[model samples]
Structures are given as C-alpha cells and as structure tokens.
Target chain A: MAVDTKKCVGCADCVVACQTENNVPHGFCRDWIVENVKGTYPSLDMKFQSERCNQCENAPCVRCCPTGASHIVEGGIVLVTHDDCIGCGACVEACPYDARYIHPQGYVDKCTFCIQRVDKGQNPACVDVCPTYCLHFGDLDDPNSDVSKALKNRSWYVLAPEAGTEPQLYYLR
Target chain B: MKEELMVSGKHIAEIYPVLHLWHWEISLYLFLGGLAGGILFFAAYFFIIGKEKEMSTTVKWATFIAPLALMIGLSSLLYDLHHKLYFWRLFTTVRFTSPMSWGAWTLLIIFPLSIIWVASFMKDMFPNWNWKWKYLNQFESFVIKYRLPFAWILMFLSIILAVYTGILLSAFNARPLWNVSILGPLFLVSGFSTGLATSMWLSKNDAERRILSRIDIFFILTELFLIIHLFMGFMAGTAVKLEAFRLFMGGSFTISFWIFVVLLGLIFPVTLEILELNGYHVPKWVPPLLILFGGLMFRFVMVDAGQITRFLY
Candidate 1:
C-alpha cells in the first residue's frame, strides 16, 4: 500500500470505511490519520498521513507469537487466526509500531489489509473509500501496478526505519 | 520559553490507546519461573555433590517447591491468556528464533526434570506413605539409580529456564527496558540470589543457614553490580534507551524501582544478612522473607514499567 501524504485531507473517511468493512469493534479502528504540523504559526506545514498496520516483512508480532496464530498469508498480509490465538499479548508487546491490540472478543486484532477484498481482486476498504484517491493499493512486484508507478515517480519514506521492521506501507511525498 | 501553542518545528507524536495487555499475572509468572529454576538448580547441585542426606529437609522442601512453583507460574501465565484452553497450540511447533517458543520448550523439559528431582527425595520425605505406595518406592529407586546423570540434566534445564525467563522479555525489542543482553545474566543472578534466600529460610541447621546466608551475600552483591551496569548500559545507549533508564531515575517507575526493588529488595536484605553474619542476631525469617518479597516486587515493577517504555517518537 502506498499513501500520497500531500493529498490526504484528514477526512477520516477511510477510517470509517475500514471499520465498517471489517466490523471493527466500537470505539476501535483498523486505520487512523496522523496529523503533524511543522514550522511556526503563520508559515506552517501540515502533514496528514493515514496510518495502520505496516505489514512488516520481518514482523515481530508473527515472530513472537507462541501459538503461531499471528502469521503471514498470501500477498504478505499479516493476520491473526482467532481460533489459534491464546491472546497472551506477547505479539501485541513485540510489535514495534504498536499496530495490534486485544479485541473485546478475546483475541489479538489488527489491520488485515482487507484480506477478503484483496483475495477477491479488490482494493482494501480504506483505499476504496479515500475521497482524494490518496491511498493506492497494488502489487509492488508488478511493474504495471499503480503502487509500483507511484513508487517509481515519487520519493517516499517508511516510518521508524531504525525499527528494522521493513514495513511495506510507504508514504509518498 | 513559557509561550503557548505557537512554536512548531516538526512535532511528531504517536496515537495509541493505553495498553494494559499484561498485568500482575504476568509479573507473578516471571517471578515464580525464576524462583523455581533457582531452587531446582541449587537442589540438584547439592545432590550432585553428595550433600543431599545431610540437608534432607531442605532438599525435600526445595525439590518439592520447585515443581510446585513452576506449576503455579505456568498456571498464572495460562490464566492471563485470552484463550486459555488453546495454550496447547504453543507446543505444536518449535521456532528457534522466538523466545516464547524457547520458553515453551524449556517448560516442557522443566516440569519433567522437576518431577524427577523431587522424586529423588520422595522416599526420604514420607516413609509411612512411601511404604504403602510401591510406585513411589519404584520411582525413588529408579531416580536414585540414575541420580548423578539426572542431577546434571536437572542443573542444565534449570539454568536454561533461568536464562530463558530473562531472554523472554529481552526479545521484545520494542520495549527498551527489556531489550538488553545483560538481562539474561541479571535474571540468572537474581534467581540464584532468591534461591539462596529460600534455602536460608528452609535450612534446618545453623551451619547450613550460615553458609547459605554467606553465599547469598555474593549473589546480592553481584545483583547490585548487574543492576548498576544495567542502568549504565541503558544510559550509554540511544535516546529511547535513556528514556527507559529514566524509569529508575526520576520517571514514573522511580519510586517502585528504588524503594521496592533497590532499597527493600537488595540493600536492606543484604544489610540485614551482613549484620547477621557479623553476629548481630537478626530475625530468623526477616532477611530471607524481605529478599523474596523484594524479588516479587522486582518482577512487578520491571514488567509494568517495561511495557510503558516504547520506541516512539
């Protein structure tokens, strides 16, 4: 997933869309917006970057999970199997990005990147509902993919590179 | 400098709800795990060196409590899980890279070893009951036949269990307070120290008590040094690490770390023990009990405070 930070308006539509699509617990969301303001008063810079699970390649959550409930499936999407999860909260603590939480239903929960939709050849709910089309979702391996083109044309950064999580989500400037 | 809300030059912040995934249950589990490992190691060592017959009561009690402590600790850990019944899934596969996996595997060996260690002392413990239970005599005879090798194996497993407890927390790199290499040795020493205290409390003879207390002082001194080095190591590390160090300095965990862990746990116990060593006649249970209580507090404070220390902007 690639996010055009400049184009995000902090509308929170994607958050609602994700919650609705995934039936995220009330008072909980699979996605949110990170709003940062730089520079002083009159001349300031505002950055609205949508944030969620980074889908890290070396996911600590997956590595630390004792039951192997937190695992990577097709398209490199990290997911938690509800039945297998003992919900020891080890994965929740192991996550460097703090991307997971214990759901009220008694299991570890986090953004799945809409695996159901992704498997059905559709974009994630957050990307689909993005009003400004700032959120782009596609296979990075495919040269013709939209996310690939965006990466080719724009410079991007991953949050907390020092964490060494190798996050797949990119923020395009 | 006191100006309100006007200056802005890249203010980076994180948004996540207050997480309370682990609580007292986890802390108790850690404490008990180390304590069990420590007891088993010391008990096995005593047996291997041919001192079991002399310290029969201590050996019987220590070996008996070792497995009980581990069982209680494992129970607490399982109780804290969201799907407690599904905990069996942890044993399905072994992942060498995962500390949880290491712990799970270590626990599998630990229980059996502890039972075997305890079995060695069973016949000596309850003769009337042992006479009625043929299986107990058979088990004790078998254990005695293989006592030396079994003792060494128990020692090996105990050491692994002790180190595994520390490495479990240190594996979580996101929490700076728990991500240090020294944690393994620190916990190992802490386990030995607490084990000595337990031995002192359970000692039937004055000579045994005096020897254990003297041995305990070494562990206490080593623990003090390791703790200092732990903080010093953090202070010499990155910004996030320094923030973690503040937990003991003047941060939110300052009071608990200093008052409960440092002063009450290490300093006070060591002082009291030293006084007793110098013929000051301290209370029989005071020093050991204080050390044991302090050990529990150490786990509580470390687990609670470590969870809050994150690598965030």
Candidate 2:
C-alpha cells in the first residue's frame, strides 16, 4: 500500500468509503485521515496523511497471540482469525500502531486492506473511492505492479520504521 | 525585518487511543500467580534440603495455599476473556512466539504439579484421615518416593512461572514500561520477597520468622533498586518511552506509584524489616502485611499505567 499525501485534501472521502464498504461498526473506522500542521501561523504547512494498519512484517500482535488467532496470510497481510481469537486483548496491547480494536461482536478487528475485494480483482475500498487518487495498492514484490512503479518513480517512507515492524504501508511524497 | 510568526495549529489527540482492556482482574491474576509460584519454590526448596521438619508451618500451609492461589488466579484470567467459551482453543496448538501460548501450557503443568506437591505432604497434613484409608498410604508413599526429583523440577517450573508473569507483560513491545528486559528479574525478586513475607505471617517459630524477614529485606531493597532503574532506563529512552516514565514521575499514575508501590510496598516494609532485624521488635504482622498489600498495589499501578502510553500518532 502507498499513499500520496501531496494529493490529499483531507475531505475524508476514503474514510467514509472504507467504513461503508467494510461494514465498520458505529463509532469505529477501519481507516482515518491524520492532518499534521507544521510551522508558524503565516508560514504554516499542513500535511494530510491517511492512517491505518501498517501490515507489519514482524507484527508484534502476531508474535504475542496465544492461540495463533492473529497471523499473517498470503500477500503479507496481517489478519485476525475471529473464530480463534479468545479476545484476551493481548494483541490489542501488542499493537504499537493502535490500529486494532475489540469489535462489538467479541473479536479483535482491524483493516484487512479489503481482502474480499482484493481477492476479486478490485482495489481496496479506500483506494477505489479516493477522490484525488492519492491511495495506491498493488504488490510491491511485483516489479511491474503500480505500487512498485510508484515507489521507484517517487521518494517514499514508512511510518515508524525505527520500530522495526517492517510495515508494508508506504507514504509517497 | 524578519517576522517571527507564532506557531499555532490544531494538535489532534484523537490518534492517541486510551484502551481499558486488562484491568484490576488481570492485575490480581499476575499478583496471585507470582505469589503462588514463589510459595511453592521456597517450600519445595526447603523440603528438598531436609529442613521440612523444622519448618512445618511454612511447608504445611504453603502446600495447600500454593495450589489454591493458582486456582483463583487462573479463574480470574478465564473470567477476563471476552470469548470465555473459546478458552479451550488455546490448547489446540503451540506457538513459541506467543508468551500467552507458553503461559497457558505453563499453567497446565503447574496445576498438576501443584496437586502432586500438596499430596506428597498429605501424611503429615491429615494424620488421622490417612489412617482411615490404607490405599491412601500407598498413594502417599508413591508421591514421597518421587519427592526429590519433583522438588528439582517444581523449583525449575516455579521460577519459570514467576518470571512468566513478568514476561507476559514485557512481551508487549507496545507498552514502554512493560517492554523492558529488567521486568523479568524484577518480578522474580518481588515474587520471592512476597513469598517470604507470606511465610513470615504463617510461621509461628521466631527463628523461622526472623530468617524469612531477614531474607525479605534483601529482596525488598533489590526490588526498590530495580524499580528506580526501570524508570531511569525509560527516561533515557526515546520520546515515546519517556511518556511511559511520565506516568510515574508526574502523570496521572504518579501518586499511585509513589505512595502505593514505592512507599508502602518497598520502603515501608524494608524499614520495618530492618528495624526488627536490629532488635527493635516491631509487631510481626505489620511488615509482612505491608509487603503483601504493597505487592497488590504495584500490579494495579503497572497494568493501568502501561496501557495509557502509546507510540503511534
């Protein structure tokens, strides 16, 4: 996953699109827009960054889950198996990004990158509905993939790389 | 002339989440689990060294209390689960990467080992009751025959269990206070100290009481030093890690950490213990009771404070 913050207007369209498409419960969202304001009033700069699960390669939640309930699946996406989750909240504390929540239905929940749509040859709801085409999704492992080309063509960075989570999500400037 | 514009923009706090997941129940579980392991460790160590007869009160009561504490602690854990019915799923597979998985298996072994440990002392525990059944004598003898090896194994498991209580929290790299490497030994020493305090309360003999109290003073001082280092280490860490230290220094958890954990749990008990050791003859129950109460408060503060600190925006 790659996000071009330069193109974001902070309209929150992707946020609504993800919530509606993913059936995110009331008062909860699978994704959100983080508006960062830097510098002084007259010389101020505003940066709008979309935030969600990083899909970490070395996910702490997966390492600490007692029942193997939270695990990595194909495409390196981290997911929680609801039926296997004991809801002990171990993964909740283990997640550094604060990206997971205990669903009202009694399971840990997080963004899945729209696995349902991705499996059916469709982009994630957030990327599909992005008004400015700011969000891009593709296989980074494939050199020909859009995400790969975006990474090659533009300078990008991952959030909290110092955390050593090896997050799959990238921010393209 | 260059103009200095005052920096003013919205600082969004919504990205920082405050989760009330594990609460008092979980804290109680950690406290009791460590206490149980500590009791068994000391009792079994004494029994293996042939001092069992001299410390009858310590061994006799600890044998039963060890298992009882674990049972109650484990029950609290089960009750804390949101998916209580699916608790059995934890046993279907093994994941070395997961501390909770390893903890479940550790508790499973501790349960039966604790039972056998208690049963081995049954002949001395219920003299008249054992005489009523001849088969009971055979069972007792069987347990007694393996007592030496059981003691060694139980000791190993007890230490593991004690350390496991701390590792459980430290494994969560997200919480700065819990992610430190010192928590394991800190918890182990604290567990041993509380166990000694508990024995001091239970034992009637002055000699046993004095010895346990003296040993506990060392443990208490060690705990105090470790706690200071825990905060110092965090303070020297990254900005997010300093947030965890703020929870103790001057944040919402400050009063609880200073008053309950530092003063009541460590300092007060150690002072009373040292005074007694120097022939001041303070009341026997005061120091030990303070230690036990302090231990409980320590867990509550740590569990609550750790959750409030976060890394992500």
Candidate 3:
C-alpha cells in the first residue's frame, strides 16, 4: 500500500468506507486518519495521513504469538485466526504500530489489508473510496503494479522504519 | 515556534495502549507465578541437599503451596484471556520463540509434578493418611521412593518457571520498559527472595528462620543490583529506553517503584533480616511480610508502567 500524503485532504471517506465494508464494529476501527501540523501559525505546514496495519516483513506480532494464530499468509499479509486466538495480548504488546485491538467478541483484531477483496480482484474499500486517489494498493513484488509504480517516481517512507519492522505501507512525500 | 498535531477518527478506547489490554490480573498472575516458583525451588533445593529435617516447612509444607499458587495464578491468566474457551490452543503446538508458549508447556509439566511432589510428602506430614485405592497407594509409594529424583526435576522446572515470568514481559520488544534482558535474572532473584521470605515466615525453628533470612538478604541484594543495572542500561540506550528509565527515575512510576518496591520491599526488609541475622531484636515476620509486599508491588508497577512505555509514544 502506498499513501500519497500530499494529496490527502483528511476527508476520512476511507475511514467510513472501511467501517462499512469490513463490518468493523462501532467504537473500533481497522484504519484511521492522523493530521500532523508543523511550524508556527504564520508559516504552518500540515499533512494528513491515512494509517492502518503496516503488515511488516519482520512482524513481531507473528513472531510473538503463542498460539500461531497471528501468522503470515500468502503475499506476506499478517492475519489472526479468530478461533485459534487465546487473546493473551502478547501480539498486541509486540505490535510497534498499535494497529491491533482486542475485539469485543474475544480475539485480537487488525487490518488484513482487505485481503478478501484483494483476492477477488478488487481494491480495498479504503483505497477504492479515497477521493483524491491518494491511497494505492497493489503488489510491490510486481514492478508494474500500482504500489510499485507509485513508489518508483516518488520519495516514500514507512512508519517507524527504525524499529526494523520493514513495514509494507509506503507514505509518498 | 509552537506546533500542534491533531489525530481524528481514532477512538481513545482502541488507540490508547497504556494498561488497556493487560492490567491487574496479569500483574497478579506474574506475582503468584514467581512466588510459586520460589517456593518450589527452595523446597526442592533443601530436600535434595538433605536439609529436609531442618527445613521441614520449606521442604514439606511450602511444597503444597506451589501447586495452589500456580493454579490460582493460572486461573487469573485464564480470566485475563479474551478467548477463554480457546485457551486449550496453547498446548496444541509449541512456538519456541514465544515465551508464553514455553510458559504454558512448563506449567503443564510442573503443575502436575508439583502436585505429585506434595502427595509424596503427604504421608510424612500426616502419617495416618493413605490413598483410597490400591493403585493410587502404589503410585504414591513409587513417587516417594523416587523423591530424590523428583526434587532435582522440581528444582530445574522451578528455575525455568521463575525466569519465564520475567522473560514473558521482556520478550515484547515493542515495550521499551520490558525489552531488556536483565528482567529474566532480576525476576528469578526476586522470586527466590519472595520464596525464602515466605518459608522464613512459616518456619518455627529459629535456626531455619535465620538461615533463610541470611540467604534472603543475599537474594534481595542481588535483586537490587539487577534493578539498578536495568535502569542504567536503559539510561545508556536509545531515547525510548531513556524515557522508560525516567518512568522510575522521576516519571509517573517513580514513587511506586522507589518507595514501595525499593524502600519498603527491598531495603527495609533486607535491613530487618540483616539485623535479625546479627542477633538484633527484629521481629521474624516483619522482613518476610515486607519482602512479599514489595514483590507484589514490583510486578504491579512493572506491568502497569511497562505498558505505558512504547516506541512510538
């Protein structure tokens, strides 16, 4: 996933679309928006970011899960098997991004990158609903894919890169 | 120049990671697990060393407490689980890298072994008691005959159980306060100290009490050294770890960690034990009780404060 920060207007259509599409429970979210403001009032700089699970290459959550419920699937997407999760919260604490939450129904929940939709040849609800076409989702493994092309021509960075998670989410500057 | 950042569409319930997921239940479980480990270790250590007659309370009586403490601790862990019914999944497979998996398996082996160890000593504590069934009686006899070997196994398992309590927290590298390697040894020493204190309190023999107190003072000193080393290591590390160090140095957890865990728990108890060892008129119960109190507070403070220290803030 690559998010074009310059084009984001903080409208949060993606947030609503995700909630509706994923059936994410009320008072909980798998994705959200962050607005960062820098500099003084007379010379202000602001950026809005749409954030969710990083689905890191070196996901600590997967490594720390005792029950193997939080495992990596094809395409390197980290997922939780609800029935297998004991919900001990080890993965919750191990996650550097604070992306996971304990589902009210008694399991850890987090963004799956809308793998269900992606598997069906459709964009994630968040990416599809993005008004500015700021959110791009595709295989980084395929150089001609949307995410690869987005990253090819722009300066991009992942959140908490120093944590060495090798996060898959790319924010285009 | 002043700058402000605003985050919208993020609910406080979901985004706030501080003590939200794990709270008092986990802390209590850690405390009880450590205490149980301490009890079993001392019990087996003395039994294997032929101090069973002198340290009867430690070797016999305290051995019974190990299983009970562990069961209660495990119950707390179960209660804290979100998917309570799915906890059986912990045993279906083992992930070596996951400390929690190691703990579940260790408990599976140790909990039963602890019970059998207690039953083996049951006839000694109550000479008239006997198993209701012949096979049960025969099994008890076999356990008694192989008691020495059981003591060694118990000692080994107890050490793993004690160290595991700390490793469980330290394994989470995302939480800066708990990511240090020192927590393993530190928790082990603290568990032993608490175990010795419990035994000392229960022992009627002044000699046993004095011996345990002297040993406990050593454990307490070791625990203190490890704690200081932990903070110093944090201070010399990354910015996030320094912030974690500040959590006890002068941050929100300062008074709790310093006053309860350090002063009342370690320093005061050690002073009392030292005085008692030197033939001073210190009460026997004071140091042990303080040590136990401090041990509990230590876990509470560590678990609560650790959740607050994160890499991203």
Name the candidate, 1 or 2, with the larger DockQ value: 2
TM-score of chain B of 2: 0.92
Clashes of 2: 0
For all candidates, state DockQ relative to the true structure.
0.44, 0.52, 0.72
Candidate number with greatest TM-score: 3
lDDT of each: 0.83, 0.84, 0.90
Docking outcome class, model 1: acceptable
Task: Please give, for residues A1-173, the per-residue lDDT of candidate 3 as tens digits.
Answer: 99999999999999899889888988888998988888887788999999999999999999889999999998989999999999899998898878898898999999988888989999999999898999999998999999999999999988888888889999999
Can you rank all candidates by lDDT, best first?
3, 2, 1
Across all candidates, what is each one's fraction of true contacts kept?
A: 0.40, 0.52, 0.76
Docking class of 2: medium
Model 1, position B112, has a per-residue lDDT of: 80
What TM-score against the true chain A does chain A of each candidate get?
0.98, 0.98, 0.98
**Which segments of candidate 1 are over 4 A away from where they belong?**
B1-15, B131-133
Predicted candidate 2 versus true structure: per-residue lDDT over B159-239, tens digit per residue: 998898889988888887788899988888888888888888988898888878878888898898998898889989988
Model 3 scores a C-alpha lDDT of: 0.90
lDDT of 3 by residue, B1-313 (tens): 6767766567848456353678888998888888999999999999899999999999998777789989999999999999999999999999998999999999999999999988888889999997889998999989888889989999999999999999999998888899999999999999989888888888999988878888898899999999989988997999889889888887999999999999999999898888777878987789989999999999999998888888862
